[model samples]
Each structure stands twice: as C-alpha cells, then as structure tokens.
Target: MSTTALSSSSTGSTGQPPPRRKAPRRPKPAPGTQRISPLRVIGLTVVWLFTAFNLLVLYWLIMAAFKTPLEIFREPLSLPATLFERGTPFRNFVYAWESAEFGTAFLNTVILVAVCSVVIVLVSAPAAYALSRLGVRGSGPMTAFIAIGMGVPFQTVIIPLFIAMSEIDLNNNLFGLALIYVALSLPFTVFLLTGFFRSLPDELEEAASIDGASATRTFWSIMLPLARGGLITALILNAIGLWNETLLAIVFLQENANFTLARALFTFYNAASYQSEYGGLLAGVAIIVLPMLVMYILLARRIITGLTLGAGK
Candidate 1:
C-alpha cells in the first residue's frame, strides 16, 4: 500500500462533524389546535360554579339547623348567635322530632333498615356463593333471571304487594315493610356478590375442602368471611334504600304511627306550617340525611372497591 493511503486510514474520521443525532420525534398534534377550546373552558367553569353553589346550599342548611325560625329568615346567612344557649341550642331538631312524630318514624326506619340490610346480606351471600362457585346446574340462567328484577321498577309491583299484604293482614306493619325491602334488595345484592365471589380465588375453597371441611363449612366459615367487603356494600345499599323509601311506606302505612321517616318527611313537608319553622324543617331534613352521610364517610373505600370490583371482570 502507498504510505499516504496507510497514514490516512490510520488517522481515520477527517474533519467531518459527527452526524447530527436525531432528536426524539415529538408526537405531532392530531390535526388542529395549539390552544384549548373556549367552549370546553366555559363548560368546566359552569361545572365548578354549580359544585360551589351546591356546597354553599349544604352549608346554609347545616347552619340553619342551629338557628331559630325568625333567625332563619331575618339573618339567614348569619352564624349562630351563641354556642352556649340554655336548654338546647338545637331545639329546632327536638321540636321537629317531636311535633312531626319523627321520633317514631326514626325508630321504625332504624328497624326497617337494620333488619332488611342484615337479611339481604345473609340471603344474598349464600345465593351468590352457590351461583358463582358451586357450579350447580342452571345457576347461570337462575342468575340471569334474578338480575332481571333489577331492571323491574318497584312501582310495577307496589299495588300487588299492597293487595297481598292487605289480604294477609300484614298492611302498615314494619315487618311487612322490611319484607318488601328485602325482596326489592335481593337482585342487586345477588348480582354484586356473585361478581365479587367470582373474583375470589378458587384455590381458597379447594384448600378448605382438602382439609376435610364440608362445602357448607367452607362457605360459612371461609367464603363468607372473605366476602365481607361485598356483604357490607350490599348492607349499606339496602339500608339507604329502606331508610329513604317513601312510596311504599306511605302506601302501605295509612296510619301516621306506622309511617317511616320518608313518609313522615312528606307529611312534614305538606303540613306547610313549616314555612314559619324553616329552621326546624331543615333540622329534620338533616336528621334524615345524617346516617347516610356518616355511612358514606366511614365505608367510602369499601363501597368504591365493591362497586368497581365487578366492572372489569
């Protein structure tokens, strides 16, 4: 080889800038827009404004619960005059409770919610286990049939239920109300728990069976305990429904004493003397709403988890 060629080859890369590195290709915008649309901005603003207005209304209602009838009108936006008033500062709550017979309604509602919620969880859990895990014949068709009840409006059956109750001498009774709540509650509970139960590992059941546990014991002792989150969700849902149920309560319970809180609220509202006692009425509304608010706060995680657990699967 020539000396010049050998020298050039040994030196290599003579004076060329290293080939420019390709910059990471940015994702190009699809078609148009460097800026957000005005309409989208306006829509977001309106949603925020609506949310703020609702929060303000809730705050006002809660404050009104502590105010007197006159204060509710004259100084509607003011805070309570004093926190240390004699007797009870929340006398409006007491007055509403007693005068509206809400005390009785509260007891009746509590009974209905508690009893029906418990019964629904108990009844649904076993049925869900059977449908989801036991592989029994016709379980799929049975589940589908039960699920149809969810789409069936309660209004459709009210007349028949009322007639049946009347013929059986069960009308206006709290127990009868509870039974109705349970029936109405079952479809959702079964659907929810069935999905939740199906999400569970079959290995757990197999382990229980291998350890000489009977199917019944495995279900009650092993399966039920694992399904607590779904059970609690069903319980809360049924309780809320039964607690706020008005149509059936008013229809089945012609007697004031037999009225649930929801029916009593309707009665209180129609009585219309409440305009003079808006604070008391507000307190009564708060009373009816408090349990649900508390439940939502306490079990929010479980509730969200249970409801969404079935969505993907």
Candidate 2:
C-alpha cells in the first residue's frame, strides 16, 4: 500500500471518537406550579372556615366555663376578665354541681356508657362474625337490613321505644338507658365489624380447622385476637356515642333524680322563673365534653390503626 493510504487506514482504526450523549430532557415544573382550580380553592376555604367556627365555639365554651355570670353577659366573646377571681368561678361550679345533683348524674353516665359499650361489643361482634364468615342463609339481606337502620332517624322510633320501655318498667332507670344505647349503636358497630372481619384472611381459620379445632374455638381463639384493633375501635366509638347521648336519656329518664349530665344541663333554663344561668350552663357543657376529649386523646392511636387497617383492605 502507499504510505499515505496506510496512514489513513491506521488513523481510521485508532482515532478517538466523541462520547455518546443523551438528549437533554426538559426540566419538570415544580409540584406547586400547576394552578389550583378555583372550585377546589373555594372548597378548601369553606372547610377551613367551618373548622375555625367550630373551634371558636369550643374555645368560647371553655373560656365561659371559668367566667362569672356578670363577665359572661358583659363580654360574651371576650376572655374572662379575671378567671382566677375568688368565689365567682368556684362558687358557680359548686352551686351548679349541687343544684344539678351532678354526683349522681356523673355516676349514672359512667355506668350507662360502660354497660352499653360492653353490650354493643358483645352483640355486634358475633353478628358481624356470622355475617362475614358463616355461610348462613339470608346473610346478605340481613346485613343490608341492619345497615338500613342507620338511615332511619331516631325521632321516628323515640315514642315507640318510650312506650315499650314503660311497658317493661325500665323507664327512668340506668339499665334502661344502657339497653337503648346498645340498640342505637348496634347498626354502625355491626357494619364496621363486618367489614373488619371480612378483611381478615381465612387462612388462619382454615389452619385451625385442619388442626381439629371447632368453629367456636377458631373464632374465639384465633379470629378474635387478630381483630383486636377493630374491637378497640368499636368500643371507643360506642363509648363516645353512649356517653354523649341525650335525647333518649332525657325521654326515658323523666324524674329529676334519674337525670344524666346532659339532662341536668337543661335544668339551668327555667322559663317559669326565667332563670337561665349561662355561666353555669357553659361550665356544665365543658365538663360533659372533657371526658370525650380525654378519651379521644388516649385511644387516638388504636382508632387510627383500626380505621387504616380496615380501609387498606
């Protein structure tokens, strides 16, 4: 070959080439760059305003709890002039406590809430289990029928329930209130628990069966333990519901001596005497709400766990 041709061939074989490169991708707009829809903005603003209004009401109630009647009337929206003022705040609470027979009411409420919660858990858990796991006839229809109870307003049944309670001589009794609470709470409790039970895998039950366990044993031993979160959630919800129930309690518990904290609050308003003790009434409301707040704070983790567990499945 000619020297120039040889050199050209050698250069072709060994010449350095430019590195391969990717085409530049356009930079993504930051997440917030997308314009929010006007409707969504309005919805969010409305939600925030609603939340703020509720929080303000709660704040007003709490502040009013410590105010004197004079302070409350003078500045309904303002903070107490002197929350620590001797005699006024303390005396109001004491007078309210004595006048309303709060000691008896408190005890009655505690017993009613506790008994009703237990009864609800007991009845609903089994009903839910049967509806979820058992191949019982009409289970679907039964479940639907029970859920339909939620849509029916309590007002429609209150008179009938009152008559029935009276027939049984259960009116004006704590046990009567407990029984009513259980019935009222059952529909939602059963619905939530049925969903929870259905979400549980059947492998555990199958395994227990293979080991010669009875159905009841499998449910009580294996299934119930696995469903602790759901049970806790049911208990918490029922407890709160029963604790705050007023209308049924007021109707069934007619006597002053049988009054609940909820019913006692109404005693502050006497149209006959025109004696509405606003400060004491607000204080009573605060007292009634305190237990619910404490309960939520205590059981918030379990509630979150149960709700998330049920939702995920």
Candidate 3:
C-alpha cells in the first residue's frame, strides 16, 4: 500500500467526513389538465343556490320569531325591532310556551324521545352485533328484510298501529307511543349498527373469547365501548326522527295532555293563525326547529367521523 493512501485513510478515520450537499428538489408535476363538465358546473350552481335559499328562509323565520307582528310584516328583511327593546325579545317565546301549553309538550316530547331512543339502541346494538359478527343463520336475508322495512311508509302502518294500540287499551298513552316509535326505529337502527359492527376488528372479539369471555360478556365489555360512536349516532338519529314525528302522535293521541312537540306545534299553528299571532307562530316553529339545528351544528363533526369510521376498513 502507498504511504500517502495509508495516511489519507488514517486521517479520514480520525475525523468526520465533509457534510453532504442536498440534491435540488424536483419541481412538482403540474396538476393534470382536466376538462370541467358544464353539466356538473350547472348542477353545483343549482345546489348552492337552493342551499342559500333555504338558509335565507331559516334566517327569516328566526328573525320573525323575535319580532312583533307589525315589524315582521313591515320590515321582514330587517332585524327584529323587539330585539332592541328590553323585556320584549322573548315575549313571543313566552306567549307560545304559555298559551299553547308548549312547556308540557316539550317535557312530554323529551321523555318520549329519551325513552324510545334508549330502548331502540339497547335492542339494536345486541341484535346488530349478533347479525354482523356472530354469523347467525340467515343474517343476510334478515338484515335485508329489516332494511326494507325502512322504506315502508309510515302512512301505511298508521291504521294497523292505531288499532293495535286501541285493542291493548294503550291509546293516548305515551308508553304505547314510545313502543311504536321503538318498533318503527329498530330497522334503521339495526341496519346502521350492523355496518358499524361489521367494520370493527374481529381480533378484539377473538382475544376476548380466548380470555374466557362469553359472547354476552365480550359484547358488553369489549365491543360495545369501541362502537360507542355508532351507538351515539343511532341514538341521535332516532331522537330526531321521534322528535319530528307528528303523524303517529296525531293518530294515537287525541287529548291535548298527551301531545308531543310536533303534535302541539300543529295544534298551535291553527290557533295562532286564527289569533294572528305571527310572532308566536314563528316562535313555535323556531322552538321545534332550533334544538335539532343546534344539535347538528355541535355534533356534525362527530357524526361524520362516526359514520365514516370503518368505511375504509
């Protein structure tokens, strides 16, 4: 070996090599050229316009709720005059609540929705887990059948349900109404939860089983916690549906005392229209609509994430 080479190698070994220069970055490829479809553009435009129009209408309705009848008519596009005055802004809300007995209806609706939503989820979660993960016989056909029930028109079942409730002497009963809501809601709830359950990892169940967890124990202790998002989604959906359901209430409940919010709203509309209580009329509408709107706004992200959680899997 050359002495110079040996010296250079010894020097290299004693000291760090020179810092390397970074290679120049490659320019990003220009976005692929694509022709925009005129039809797609037109469709998007129309959809946006429709959404804007709906938002405008909602704004007007909310504004009108705080306005007196004269201000609502005279300056529909402007802010509520009552909003500027102390102690008057909520007069319409108070009137709607007191005159139409909306307070009672609100409590009734809350109880009915809560009970029905809980029952629906309790019944659905187990059934969904069994159908989706347990490999039950005819699960596919049964799931399909249940999903088809969602398409069954509420109007078609009105008479039969009413007769059944009547025969059982449960007419005008909140309990009976909740039972019917649960029955009607089960199909959709089960269908939604089945998909969520199927998306869950099977390994968790296998691990639980290996640890001597029975099917029942495995479901409650292992799977149920993981699928909470889907369960919450199901609960909210059922609550909203039951909250807005007036047809069933109309069919079953005759007396004012048993009225749900939706049913009471219908009754109030007729009375308020006759009395020319436009502000109170809109307040009633706001009462029914705003809870759902606020709920959706607050939970929109969670709902979307819950819905799409296992989609890719």
List the candidate numbers ranked by TM-score, top first: 3, 2, 1
C-alpha root-mean-square deviation, candidate 2: 5.1
Ranking by lDDT: 3, 1, 2
As for lDDT, the candidate ahead, 1 or 2, is 1
Q: Worst ten-residue run, lDDT, model 2?
A: 267-276
Per-candidate TM-score against the hidden true structure: 0.80, 0.84, 0.85
Clashing pairs in 1: none
Candidate 2 structure quality by residue, lDDT tens digits, 1-313:
8997777776675574445699999998665455876666887899999999988888888888788777877887897767575645465577667777788888878877887898899899989999989878999999999999999999899999989988999998878877888888899999889989999998988899899999889889989988888998999988887778788877888787778888776664452125656676666777789889888989898998898887777
TM-score preference between candidates 2 and 3, better one: 3
**Per-residue C-alpha lDDT of model 3 across residues 107-149, encoded as one tens digit per residue:** 9999999988999999999999999999999999999999999
lDDT of 2: 0.82
What overall lDDT goes with each candidate model? 0.84, 0.82, 0.89
Q: 200-227, model 1: which lDDT tens digit per residue?
A: 8889999998999998999999988887
- Over 4 Å off in model 2, which ranges? 1-35, 271-273
**C-alpha positional error of residue 114 in candidate 1 after TM-score superposition, expressed in Å:** 0.8
Model 2 steric clash total: 0
